[model samples]
Target: MKIIAALVTASINKPVSTTIGLLILFMLSAMTVVAEQLPPPSATTEYSKEGADTCLQCHDQDSKFPVLAIFNSPHGNKNTKHGPFSSAGLQCETCHGAAAAHTVKRLRKGQVRAAMISFKTKDVISNDEKNQLCLACHQATTTRHWLGSVHQSNDLACTDCHQIHISDDPILNKAQQLEQCGQCHTKEKVANHSVFSHPLTSGQMGCTDCHSPHDANNNQLLVSDSVNETCYQCHAEKRGPFLWEHEPVTDNCLNCHRPHGSNQAALLTQRAPYLCQNCHNSDGHPSFSYGSDDAQGQQASAFLLGRSCANCHAKIHGSNHPSGYKFQR
Candidate 1:
């Protein structure tokens, strides 16, 4: 480029004594010598000569950024198959994108900013784009259903719960997972805090045990085909091939139970007599009927003294005995 500029200058600075033929030849040579072409501003994205090493210049442990911890993460493990530093031998650029233009000094809207995708910078990458960076290598079984999932639809970023620089992400820890998910799930948190609820707060179970955050096949994000199927995993006794099957039990446990929590005992939606009356006809059985005695043509208390419907119908879920038509075997 310098040679071309010098040649052009010499051609233009020729004195009057110079021959027209010589001047014309110099002008022609200068015209033929095109300046060394450079890519336009839009095409400035190029890989730096040094990859991760370049990024470490500013992100090293001594710096405020402190990215040396990533070396201890799976992403930096060169032996891990198909990982960021695996057979492909990718570096920081593999996830952060090309740094050639980003490393070079630049200004945007009166602010000095990186030209490439630096996740910390505003607008450098959208949530979807940030997810794609991880999906580039993580689009596997667990992630297959991640697309269009509730978390994805809400523009959730993997970094929101995962700490890629560390070996153990908070979401992967049993005790920490509840709190991590609870940050955004305040309603479920309150439900789990209730007296009668799944043992989530105590760490006996995790949200992932019942809900598949990666899946959106159902509104509850249950890991199983249906609500009953999910419950049957732990309450196999309730999943009976009984001689007398309760319709509500077989249909859905939620019909009679609050899955998360409830003020009622055994997570029941309501105290039994009223709850049973929702589906059971009070006049059908004169013994437990709450209907007026005048309508029944008999006199009997409303069973309010010891009126929990499930107290007598102990096998309310189902009954294996032949004579258990009323679920009281």
Candidate 2:
């Protein structure tokens, strides 16, 4: 263990040894190397006699793995029976499993330690097994739908986004949460940087505003039953059962708007007249262009050249106006 620490410390102090330190870290992370290797499962089933006190002796301040900050976190509360300082008294071992075999007086040079549940995906611990321990306590509330969630189905452990040992977990913050999620959803990250997008990148809004990351029941991870309903949470004015209704407006918001990001204004899938032209160009709407040089002119069709169908049909979404049969309030 000292040998591993020396390598890590050298990497920190001497910039040239970074590669060597990284290699050592990678090997040590596997938990199969001699320096960090744990014993067989049979040998490590018992909890330490001193419980958390034994582990804290080495992990205290001035040690490589300092955990004093955990005292400020929920898991470290001594008052609660479920916490580390509980009366029944299984502190560090409560989540880390038994450490009795690991605290064997002193670790001699090149000797392997007892097996420990490190809660790391790439280590000897299986991701599901590591998550099961957390699920034992956090199976309710927001995590109730975690069984078949996208993050769960993708084999992501709770620790992947959560920092349980620390006082401040980045996932709790709206802006930092986007960065945590952006680690995997790279496409969304790129879209968020585009000219126009939801206020997520600016911290004014959040991914959880419309999505339930732990929910598998909702379509596209939406907070509501559908995309339009999700939009109506903020744009409630557009959700009217007006005197005149546009069929497409009641259908799906995505039919015209790109919910994430787009180059067009108002997140439209395409420009206005061309967008309205997608459906309206065929039925009594002029098929040919109303240009300057055209001799075969339909003078009334020139109104469509104003760059938007909404210019004439002001009530694009719907119209409460009595003279709004064509939605031109």
Candidate 3:
């Protein structure tokens, strides 16, 4: 009886010890699994240019983006035509740089860089760098005056006014360069599209008609810095030392003309006859009786075609004859 009891106790102890060992092994296996599933540490380093070159294998000659076009331009021929790219080591990689990190983030679902290039801030280049970039390869003639222009003072970038690609659209077309200027020149746009404006609608004239892009020593982009000189470029007939000269014409064009675009004929700021009446009296002239905005003053203003003060005083700026008071040319 004693031996049978010893045997039963030994058997029970063996199974109990095995169960305890198995439970310990199960807990340790679960802890190992949890540790393996945790995320990796954050990245602190940047990517290198060599790593970036790998992309050219697929990106070069890509139909989606033809970087080769820019290479064909003056920007790309800096080595011979210009000297900046070779001297400064400013190649295709300089502007774009290593895109590996950005590409990796997109592919592996990792963190992205804060500055993603876009239409508004595509190049990531600084404003001061713009002049340097252009001057590096191109001649300094066209953009030299830009350094002290109103646009520079206001932090306006070169890209803001000019399109690098130069689109074929009306606004981007080279011949219609004024359309680009018109986009931001709200007053010009309004005056040009106004009901009584000049042939601005047909694109017969542009901003460059009266203004120069480069080497205007006086008005930055104007053909002539002096207001009178600029005006005389086209209205050479009016630029005269006649018997009498209009004070506004002698002083400045802005005194009477808007230049950009105006609701009045020939880009005048105010309506006809009234514009004349500002200086001319109302004794017996047809304009005095008919061109005023006042109900009783002038119904003739509405009846006139061009709404031009020239309708009456054809020789507006000056008169040569002894009795040219009416400016009848």
Supply the global lDDT for candidate 1. 0.76
lDDT preference between candidates 2 and 3, better one: 2
lDDT of 1 by residue, 29-62 (tens): 6666543343222223787787777778788778
Error at 323, model 2, angstroms: 2.6
Error of 2 at 210 (Å): 1.2
lDDT, candidate 3, 148-265, per-residue tens: 6666666666567654422233433444665677667767666766656545557776666666653466644677768778778877887888897777788887888876566666
Write down the TM-score for model 3: 0.61
The regions of model 1 sitting more than 4 angstroms off are 1-44, 61-64, 105-111, 281-305
By TM-score, the best candidate is 2
lDDT of each: 0.76, 0.77, 0.58
* TM-score against native, each model: 0.74, 0.76, 0.61
Superposed by TM-score, candidate 3 places the C-alpha of residue 116 at a distance from the truth, in angstroms, of: 9.3
RMSD of each: 13.3, 15.5, 19.3
lDDT per residue, candidate 2, 1-329, as tens digits?
67667666666755666767677676766555654554443337788897777888888878877888888887888886566566764778777877788888788899888768777665556677677778877777678888878878889888888887778888888878679888988888777887778888888887888888877466588888888889999999999989899988999998898887888888888877788878785567654345554434645545545436776787889999989988888
